[model samples]
Target: MSSHDVHDEHLPAHRSETTPATEPIADPGLPAHQWRPTDVDPAAEKRAERQVATMFGLSAVCTVLFVVSYFVFEIGEVTTTIAGLGASTVALGTTLAGALLFIGIGIIQWARKLMSDHEIVEMRHPAASSDADRAETVAAFNTGLEESGIGRRPLVRNSLLGAIGVLALPVPVVLLRDLGPLPGDTLKSTIWEPDMRVVRDVTGTPIRPADLEVGDLVNAEPAALFETDEEGEPLVEGVELQVEKAKGAVILVRIEPDDITPGPGRDDWGVDGILCYSKICTHVGCPISLYERTTHHVLCPCHQSTFDLADAAKVVFGPAARPLPQLPLAVDSEGYLVAQRDFDEPVGPSFWERDSR
Candidate 1:
């Protein structure tokens, strides 16, 4: 090796590490803190306190008015009009809304004006704690609890509790209103009568035997479901009747007469080649309308529960446990279709206590 190479190996290869230049660094501290007007001026502080208190005071008054309005306005009463809304609705809505809004404004004002406004910086240490550190934390928590003085200041605590307790009253009161009268036996019968003519649902035209071709499916309702009584009174109307008809709905289908295998007592039910069955799926009450005429099977779109219309509407496929209910069909003197009577059994999805007999 050359002498230069030998000398270079003996010398320390460059500096082992690089150190930043050690000069005294200047500290850039936080900017000067500005005091609020309320903190410096006694008059401003008093005014701000009054403003917050006024907001809270108004909120209390509105809460009282909410209670009053609950009784004052009858729910459906029609009185003076403001922009086409009833005066009671407007008053109740505004007063109740103001009650909540004013309280929120009051809390915001209190925090802005009166609550401690000092900025604090906390230095975080490692999350894992030693016994000594935990003891110190507990001591600090006790000191904070003592300083908060919540137990001694009953006015604020009591008022807060009162407001919260009063707010809970309406929840139970509204729930009690839901426990009112229920419809009994109303769901068991529809507007159908002994000789009511069967009609198409929307067009309201009477369904005649000739109107249905082979394999044709028709959605029909009892004529009484749409008729007025002799005294011009509607046989059924409103929610009670609607729910009844939904469970008693029927569908009429016309197939070849020789295709049918009637249930034990339903031989005389169909008129000519026409047969009728309930529209509701016995499994989950979905309207079963998808028909396969060649197979004589009607499929429920919901769960694919297929029923054999040719054999007493028996369950032929899918999850349904029972057959669809059959409606007896007859023709009136005018050659329009009519129901023999109300369904012999209840219609709709089977319940736990349902009796199929």
Candidate 2:
């Protein structure tokens, strides 16, 4: 008896057991194939073929409509609407969805009702293929292509081809004009000049050294966001205010004075235990400042990129290729915390022109 059989023999009669190796297992062949209506009925086959072709034709119509709608409506015109959404948005979205959805349905119906219905059986084999196996695979691929009858059905084939060709036309049509003009030198600078007060992001109240405690992390922006000029006109408003706040976003963290390891020529960058760094991640421009007070490490939520805030915000883990840029800080004559100047390096994800290590 085999080892497994011997082991089974030692078990009690009450134990659950399987058959012995000495007995042979019979093979059960596949069930008989069932024919579909489209397979045996000539009328049904023609009907299915027409259905798939009709779907493909509709897809082509939707794509053509999408292209037409692109030029039909003005972007910001408030006069027209479909259920409160812009007429342009509703038209573009519905047509594009229909274009993709109809093509997908057409392909699925064609495969199910018109393509080859033979059920294939493949035996388990070693991963490495022999020369004969490769030749047989190529022969089977050619056989499948012939069985699909794509060459015989001119209506379905031509409609599908036309739909696919028209689908790609919308890409360049929207990409060329949808996005506004280039950002030109706007990203290279911020409104944070020398002596600009660092204010709370939402409250817009200026911060002092006394306002922060050890292990405190605060989100801040430049005072120019909320302040007014001599004539009482806002310093910045609307899109300009938004752009400046996005570029000047910063995080102020207070660590133990003894824990800081400042970079060269940056010894006086902090006051007491307070230090400031950009709130943007270096990897992909995600906003950061998820702080671990014990380790003084801030994490980017998007990609989990970690930066050691105590040591010039140097990246310690994750996909970030560089450290968070440090913003120099000082106290104004009014005892409010202020920026010594704009960040020495650009603050955000690395770009082609920024090669700083």
Candidate 3:
């Protein structure tokens, strides 16, 4: 076919001359009003009002019961059980749910039975409001208030108010516990101490400078994690061990001797080009070991915070505000790597009490 004929073939066909024009959909007008039992009968209306009030009353009672259960049921150790769940957990969950559920049900009941039942169509208009529309909105709000009968139904209103006020009590009641034992100097210190062996993580084997070659990185922790007291009990165990392990995590890296540029007084920090730094990222405390052997840069996988290990673990290219806290390394009498001293500064993310700078 000719190009013109091909173009014409692809063009949309014109409407048929016999085709009828499309008609607009007819509006389905509102159905005839049906009066509810509460609307027509004074007795039913009074009963519904009492029911809504009762729901709100129950909400307030549940709120009080929630507070009581918090104290009555010991949180730790399941001394009691309800359907295989801890008694304290079940009591707290049920009471809190009851407090919220009853308040919601009371409001739904109040709207369905007591609030104005008249139905009216709202015509769609421009979304941008004019001055007149704003005034109309305020007027509509007042009309809705009047129709809701909040002022007339003092029982429902007062009960709902009381329930809401009681609900707020749980906020402080739960939050006050979290004020907690102050962190003290915990964040500022770790299990690391002078002469503490830098042991390989998981295996607890002490590391030596000879064990790593140039560009090698080994995740390490303080030896206290594996040591024992005079009585043969673990020096650090349970939750205490876990907390100290996290804070005391370190990474030992071996770089070329000439590649390292130590900061002031950090000359002796590394032993034979082997240096130790916190495994925790200075940005948000995510453990980082993504190392670039060529550039001597370690990247935090969490936020892409890069630190140059050769440059005293300085922040190189990401959101980390400070250098990774370095641990001074030394050789013990056994020739195993050990910490000369704890880090001079804190490790991990900044907290409210610490000077972030």
Candidate 4:
């Protein structure tokens, strides 16, 4: 006999005599199944199927409207507003939400009202199922497919398929517009023309060499933004002005003449001991102003990229691949600091077309 049979043979028959006898609990079987209205009545079943198909049809219609609104709405102009939201945003959001909502409702209704509802008991078993259990599982799946009625209910099946197919059309259409037009030479240059005064950022007052002392770091901007603001007709306005300001923003810092180390061909780029460099970080374009006066190091708070401003803003500590772009500086007849010309290279993050390292 097997080892299990041998172990059972050792058990004493007199053990039952010493043990107290107890009555075994009887099994309580599953409750009686109840038939749904749709299962009993053919008319109710037909009605449920139609309801499901209608939901899917509505989903397809909303998906079509979503595509329509994407092209019809003119962005940024804000021609119409509804309860503080733009009409374009309202239409696009509503239509897209409707499409997803209807599809979800249709699937739920299909399972509840028209699909199989028979109950079956699943007993506890080993973690690894037996071959017989696997066969039963396959059979149960096939039974579910039959009871779901996808073949019998042509209208519901066709509408659901069509709704899902049309939903994908909006993705490619949105992507085409989102790619936008080519950037051309816009990224390579800023509004920093020759003789453009380097003024204080918010105050817009021109910066004279005397305004800075050793170890002083001042945030500055191109004077062209505020010059026309005083004239009442700004040279750049709205989004254009915002874009120019971001690219043209700079930091003016003065170090001791003995501590300055100018890059090749940039010896005269500083006025007295004051040097100018782009305020935008080369790594992902985060604005950097956190400066350490003692080491002449500027740190980008977003990613901790450190640059030594006294040494041509070279990356000394973190993930930045290159040095900050330096602004060639000069002094006008009024003795105020000005740009000799635009930045020789791009100011912000590196891109596909530029050699950044």
Candidate 5:
């Protein structure tokens, strides 16, 4: 419809009569309604009603086939192929798609061939509803329900209900399959242990106090990441290495010894001017490395959560509610930086157990 072709009922009586001819907005009345073939003939009406019922019945059949296909063809069984796609995928997808598509078609047919087709203009009114307004709304809803004819057409209504009921059966089955083994105390600790050498991330070389100048920040991880067995294969490989490194990552920063403000029982957590804290942000566990050396503050680029590196890595600014967990640091006899012990408090984002600490 043209922008100016709004119905004449929408035009205001106060509209100017003296407006220029070209400037006057066109006011087209409601378009003429054409009756469908089913509306004009008794036989055509019955045929259309039957067609809608047939589509709904087919939808029910497809839903039944979906369950049968689930057990007949296993998930990983690729021996049987249809057009290079797995037989299981083809059967499950086609049946499920048809189940949804047929129901949509049946609803469209019902609305187009039988429902009310009158058009009426409703005037604007106050937004709030009173007792009288609520009564009228309920009356209108009952009138619409009568017009839908679901009460008289058992074939169409019952088939649609049956198809929808069968479609919901797969949900609980899939959810039960996805709930694997439970996790027990896995998230409470990391690979860090007593005397674990703190090494640079990319290069496996250990860090020393002199290696980091004052106002310097270095990204480091536990030496377990680069450890290998006698066969020259990783001691921790695959998903295990990925999970450990993510939790064990830390940032080493150097500040004046007097600038360090220790939390309770944390005075010995640092060595000389060097302090080590978990790189993971407390807000949502993003890797924090963006450091302002002058302020001894590191910012997480993911959400701009800044942490104070010198003052026990307390939350200086942003959305983080807790301070970064400090890793107790000690020097080994060989003059390499090492973890005195695993962090007293769990690292990463807060969990159920962290609240008690």
Candidate 6:
């Protein structure tokens, strides 16, 4: 009978009979170890080495191709459609995927065929170990290293190192492309120009100062966006036109002329207390429309960023990092409100290494 069965047999039969409980038994040693096919067969080991080396070699080639693709294709080129996809996109994606795939395959192959594949069974040890236990652990680690044969396999080791080293090359090169041409003066300017009348967004109707009440807030855009050429065709259309309109979007608010406070060098910028500011939030580019007439605060629904329109659109509360960019305003000869010029500074969030001017 097993020890557990024997212990159970020795239990007291009657409730009146008192007896002490037996202590828990200790664990027995581990089962016998087993060897793997690669450990016993030289042919299998050699085949595994070749397979791993091939994977590493393929990975190295993919890395080289990634670098080549960086220069070969223009970024926006949209030719060579495969299911309506660009050739540059396909080449770069496939090469990069192959680079990662081969390296993963190589490591898996090495672990399955070349690295130590012995089945070891370890006995349960105490939670806290003694000096002897530490020594035994170190000895086992050394034995495992020897069994792996990494020291003897120079070809596999060097090839893997080379593949991994080459893999690093594409990373820096890709990042270099990001570090290329910056926005420069693009951020500092918008579609707003001098004498361009302020038009209502979407309807494209020119806004006169009389159209707005004291507490009214109207979403406005540059009048130039709605302009038609001599042929009666839209000067700007499609994505390009949409982008320009979005960046140039503004909010027109009319308050008591005495309530408006024009900043330094901006005395004549407003028309009859009708001040205008970029609708795009300076915090993170959310379209702001919420207006509190009593406070003169325009609140961005995203991030709850509040800008005091009464005080040059200064950041009064919330996560906004900077004040909203105000557009210089004036009245045209026809009584329609117009922009004096574009914004004095950039209208969006600060970016890496960006110069605001």
Q: Where is model 3 more than 4 Å wrong at Cα?
A: 1-54, 67-72, 75-84, 119-146, 151-155, 165-169, 172-186, 228-238
Better model by lDDT: candidate 2 vs candidate 4: 4
Instruction: Give a tens-digit lDDT track for model 1, residues 145-214.
Output: 5644335434444554555455457634643654743334433455566767888876668998999999
Error of 6 at 144 (Å): 6.9
The CA lDDT at 60 in model 2 is 85
Better of 4 and 5 by TM-score: 4
Query: Ten-residue segment with the worst summed lDDT in candidate 2?
Result: 180-189
lDDT of each: 0.75, 0.88, 0.89, 0.89, 0.85, 0.84
TM-score of each: 0.55, 0.60, 0.72, 0.71, 0.62, 0.74
Output the lDDT of residue 210, model 1: 95
Over all chains combined, what TM-score does candidate 4 have? Answer: 0.71
User: Which pairs clash in model 5?
Assistant: none
For model 3, the local distance difference test gives 0.89
lDDT of 5 at 318: 90
lDDT of model 3 at residue 119? 87
Give the worst 10-residue stretch by lDDT in candidate 6: 73-82
Q: Specify the highest-TM-score model's number.
A: 6
lDDT of 2 by residue, 29-83 (tens): 7788999899999999999988998898899899888888888866653446779
- Which runs in model 5 stand beyond 4 Å of their true positions? 1-99, 105-146, 150-186, 351-353
Query: What is the full ranking by TM-score, best candidate first?
Result: 6, 3, 4, 5, 2, 1
Is 3 or 4 the stronger prediction by TM-score?
Answer: 3
lDDT of 6 at 253: 95
25 Cα displacement, candidate 2 (Å): 34
At residue 237, what lDDT does model 3 achieve? 87
Record all residue pairs in model 1 with backbone atoms less than 3 Å apart, i.e. clashing.
Answer: none
- Global local distance difference test of model 2: 0.88
Whichever of 2 and 3 has more TM-score, that candidate is 3
lDDT of 4 by residue, 1-357 (tens): 999899878878885357677889888776888889999999999999889989999999998888888778777855666787787789888988998999999999999989989887778988898999999899989998899999999988999999988887774666476775344566689999999999999999998999898999999999988866555887788988898999899999999988999998899999888999999998888999999999999999999999999999999998898799999999999999999999998878866775522
Candidate 6 regions with alpha-carbon error over 4 angstroms? 1-51, 74-78, 82-85, 122-158, 161-184, 231-233, 352-356
Per-residue lDDT over 256-292 for candidate 3, one digit per residue giving the tens place of the 0 to 100 score: 9999999888999999999999999988889999999
Model 3 TM-score, all chains together: 0.72
